[model samples]
Target: MHCLLFLRIVSALEHRYKYFRFREDAVGKPGHTPIKKWTAAIRQLAYGGATDMFDEYLHIGKSTARECLQYFCEGIREIFGEWYLWKPNPVDCHQLIDMHGSVHGFPGMLGSIDCMYWEWKNCSDAWKGMYTTGFKGKHPTMILEAVADY
Candidate 1:
């Protein structure tokens, strides 16, 4: 996600859900930040990253990671579902086709393939030349080829 969008999500979720809010412990030690919990949740949801990975990087527990994921999904639905989840009407389709044609010279095209940078961590020597993301500043990056919401 873009930085602004990610921060917007973090801010919205934090305001809407108490679980995403930053808190202080009884000893007055600062607890996890909103970014930390949201990062753990988005990493798992978007990259399929392991929950244990956040334990070391984000200092979040496995159970908390799962909880974050659940609440993240819930918050997204509650916060953005109205504007983003509906199907496009015919007027919307016409506008999209017109816009795409003007931008890319492609008309009558509606479906879009969602592509994302995916780093290849354990690529073999022979396959190292194939994947290059540039997502983790790693050697290999793979473009995800999933058809999202189409």
Candidate 2:
């Protein structure tokens, strides 16, 4: 969520979709800005919280938050799906390997990869033993791993 990247997305979304554009209410007061709308959407997506959790802070109702989430998903899918939502072809893989070699002096590791330990609060007692790594006094955690080519 770098400011510039967020602004770039906001600009694209605001330009492509009227719902994302700022407007005035009936009383001539400005309504929600694109930033607020995107923020609500991103929070719901990134945090997986209740839709109403940040409504007060964002000055939007639960329904609006829900709407923002739905539309944000749809807009992102429509706007970025073509380039990002596809399997890598052979040519693409080769290019990625080359790019990685050039950038990091590594081979075939064309992207950032990471693993994270995520605490699983309220994990059932039966599964707790399977989830932990014998760490004393620590909650059970699951490892989340991901690879990304940015």
Candidate 3:
């Protein structure tokens, strides 16, 4: 996810969802939860990464990390579903065709596929050379190509 979008989601969840807020324990002591930990959990799950792999860096337990993932998914659906999750209508299709034709001289254009970089953290040293590509950077990153119209 983009950094700004991720931050916006975190802020929205923190304010709108009571479950994401840090709580106070006995004697008014603040709970140990940090919003970053929760964000990390959700990002990993969204990116198809292993939950336990983040335990070392985020200093979060496995069970708590799983809980964070669940809450993050639920909160995202509740908060951002209206604007982001929708089916295209006839008007939308017409607008897309017109816009693409006017801008790029192509009518009836849907979209194009592009490459995305993903770091290889657990890649073996011997295979790192094979995975290495100069497209994005020096790191051994797997390129993700996807097609999107909007």
Which candidate gets the maximum TM-score versus the true structure?
A: 3
Report backbone clashes per prediction: 5, 0, 0
User: lDDT tens string, model 1, 6-68?
Assistant: 889999999999998989989999888999999888899876766776777788999999999
Q: Kindly list the per-residue Cα lDDT of model 2 for residues 4-35, writing each as its tens digit.
A: 98998888889889999999989999988999
Candidate lDDT (C-alpha), each: 0.82, 0.84, 0.74
Q: How does candidate 1 fare on TM-score? A: 0.64
Q: Rank by TM-score, highest first.
A: 3, 1, 2
TM-score per model over all chains: 0.64, 0.62, 0.65
lDDT value, residue 46 of candidate 3: 65
| Candidate 3: tens digits of C-alpha lDDT, residues 47-149 | 6666765667777666777777887878778888888978789898899888878887778886777887898878779657777887557668887778755
Clash count, candidate 2: 0
Q: Which stretches of candidate 3 lie above 4 Å from their native place?
A: 1-8, 24-34, 114-141, 146-150
Assess the local accuracy of residue 9 in candidate 2 as a C-alpha lDDT between 0 and 100: 84
Of 1 and 3, which scores higher on TM-score? 3
Model 2: CA > 4 A from native: 90-117, 120-150
Q: Which residue window of length 10 is worst by lDDT in model 1?
A: 126-135
